[model samples]
Target: MSNILVVDDESSVLSAFQDLLGSGGHTVATARRAEAALELLKADPFDLVVMDICLLGMDGLEALRRIKEQQPTLPVIVMTGHGTMQTAIEATKLGAFDYHLKPFDPAEMLAAIDKALESTRLSRSQVVLDPETTAAVAGDAIIGRSPGMQQVYMAIGRVAATEATVLIRGESGTGKELVARAIHQHSRRAARPLLVVNCVAIPDTLLESELFGYERGAFTGATARKTGKLEHASGGTVFLDEIGDVSLGIQAKVLRVLQERCFERLGGKETVHVDVRVLAATNRDLEEAIAEGTFREDLYHRLNVVTIHVPPLRERREDIPRLVDYFLERYARELNTDKPPVAPDAHRLLQESLWPGNVRQLAHCIQRALIFTRGYPIQAGDLPLPGEVGSDRAAVSGLGDQGLGELVRRYLATYTGDRAHEAFIEQAEKLLISEALRRAGGNQTHAARLLGLSRPTLHAKIQKHKLHADTDRQAR
Candidate 1:
């Protein structure tokens, strides 16, 4: 549970938040004014702050500025019933994690709180490079002693202090985001916010506005000015994942930001200047994309100032055992169960598997094993079946050799149910949605586009199938 401080003049508002957040297992402290909130903060540590803009004695914006000055990494959510475009912009400039109108939906507020907490964790928590030091630590760690991992560590150390833009390249589930976090955490801007923008997760139409804030009345439905991630992340670092997925127009704008450290907002004439370090990651081959004329060459050159390639898990087989052990221990704690030992045969099976999904797949496998084992030693039978372990390429090749008609005929011959057609459709839908989510890095918006479905539909299907997308380390 986290410690959250709520500052508002209204006693009812404070009591409502206290009840809402308290129900979520967070320790909530209420203060009638910003001054009291600041005093509480000075006396005790808080994981987050939720304050109103019109607090008596001292306003919320001033408190926000002071809080950021005292603790730069502490995330605060600013709320106001009299919110204006200027208030939102000022709050963002003062480093508020988010701004909300009064009487906001409890679910959205909780989601914002969770996002802010996660952001704080990623920025403040240290990413240990030594595998030996990881088992005892509760946070994230890059666990591997292989030569590939060693080189990666060296590269992060050598370039983290510098201002050069870094491009982290790796296949899906290879921990590219971990490298980005390590760089930000060890850099001169470690105390500053590290804003992560998943390019593929956001649609192209919205991506521009997300990076560059929109001016008031810039387009239809533009009710107020909105500050973008780039502007908010000024004086910090912005980790752009799947940078290659950005369109040519957005690429040119980003190129300008890198080249000049300035860009105009959508429909605004003023050129805003920002000082931010850019770290980009992508699983796609930029050279191939450039050749196809879908990616900009100049932008590629700019982002490639420093390159760090994360090797796929198959290339570093020796590290698999360590990774497995780490996940087993980590998930056991999260599952709130005694750590179970891996059977000799189970260990062998894991070591010999192709691991097409790499570390993320292994983590999910271990988590599943722990849940099913029920305090018993984990065995190979608890793991995913052999047919579930290979890459998409292997599956497609097998399908081609068998042909669709023959495959269906074989399944029909073995089937005793009359609802075979419905079963096949359901199975196909589940697999498609799962693979799409995996390819999209657990981004529901992008996965919906890939599957030719709306976001809500995709979300419902995911819920229906009880599928969990590996968002943290997958497609990094």
Candidate 2:
């Protein structure tokens, strides 16, 4: 049985914990004040501590600071009858494992204690965090040797061994999810499930029920009781991809889960407590979202405990040769064909080209090139890319040496855009379409011919870029 210390000013609170925890096969010690709790802590070894914010002598926050000073790794759960955002944030920053409202659910309290004990057990293990060796710890799906990637590996090594909430910031397709997986793979909860919830893929209406689950009749089509990602992950990890897309309402609930380890399902009265670590990724700037009032500041702080920024492929072009070889070998084995040689010019072009889609795009390009490369070696001409279109090149011949695509590629190579690929493509497409429409005197047919695109394709592009109405107004 694990030894637990219960500290509170109220006699009933102490008594309730004794009865609740005692039945759960744990030995409990009670302290009426902060001094008493500290005395007990100094005198004996306890697995966990549950303390109240308001005490007879020193306040709980002060006592929490002292406890952490003496036992840095000890997990402390602080509760208050009166809760405020500042208090909650302060408790978390001061290293409290969790902070809850007073008269918290008994089940939630019990779950918190269990998690603390489990974390202690895991932390006590002899496993060490070694940066150079941690890549192998996750089985090498993350292949990179550049300084940028090396820093990423080191961050994973340092953060994986702890229960810190990680916020991975990177452009799309930069393998943010892969970094999340690597963190989970090296964690104490590696044997458990690593559940993923793509925030952008799921609609805002269904995201709440999807994450916190729901009762049998929570909403239409809710025919059966469902376990949410958080509950399902139990002792594992939950990776929230595109986390910036989460709605404000769902963001509040997510903050609760990260803070108190408890959440109630939709249309369910009982709270479902869990012990899940959170790892979230997003291409959007959460700080910007917060300033715009679309995202919660408190939730941002809770998730930003340990930030891991994954560098895009362009920042680490030196690793292209290694990554190319890895992808080529894998695809060759998968296709059951001999690995084709990559011409030196092809490799040079790949390393120099601006990869908007990062590593993921490169891997798919290799696979596609391998399929149609015929014979053996793959050359620069064999690569099928938008920049290689001769028809479009003829259209922008008026621009002299480089076309609009080349200009855009050069701009992307030199610029630092947080959402570079998407923003760059959108801006370039708009500029090209606008220039064409201007040259054609806003005639759709003439503009389409000038750009060497069919009428339907040009119209669709115009609509996609919302240039039809604006350009028509300019033409008039």
Which candidate number has the best lDDT? Answer: 1
* Candidate 2, poorest ten consecutive residues by summed lDDT: 130-139
- Candidate 1 achieves a global lDDT of 0.84
Q: What is the C-alpha lDDT profile of model 2 across 183-295, one tens digit per residue?
A: 88788877655667787666566778768877768888654444566764666788898887676788899999998999998988877778889999988777767776667
Inter-residue clash pairs, candidate 1: none
List candidate 1 segments past 4 Å from native.
23-25, 81-89, 100-111, 388-476
> How far in Å is the alpha carbon of 82 misplaced in model 1?
4.5
lDDT of 2 at 186: 87
Look at candidate 1 and tell me the lDDT of residue 81. Answer: 94
**Lowest-scoring 10 consecutive residues by lDDT in candidate 1?**
467-476
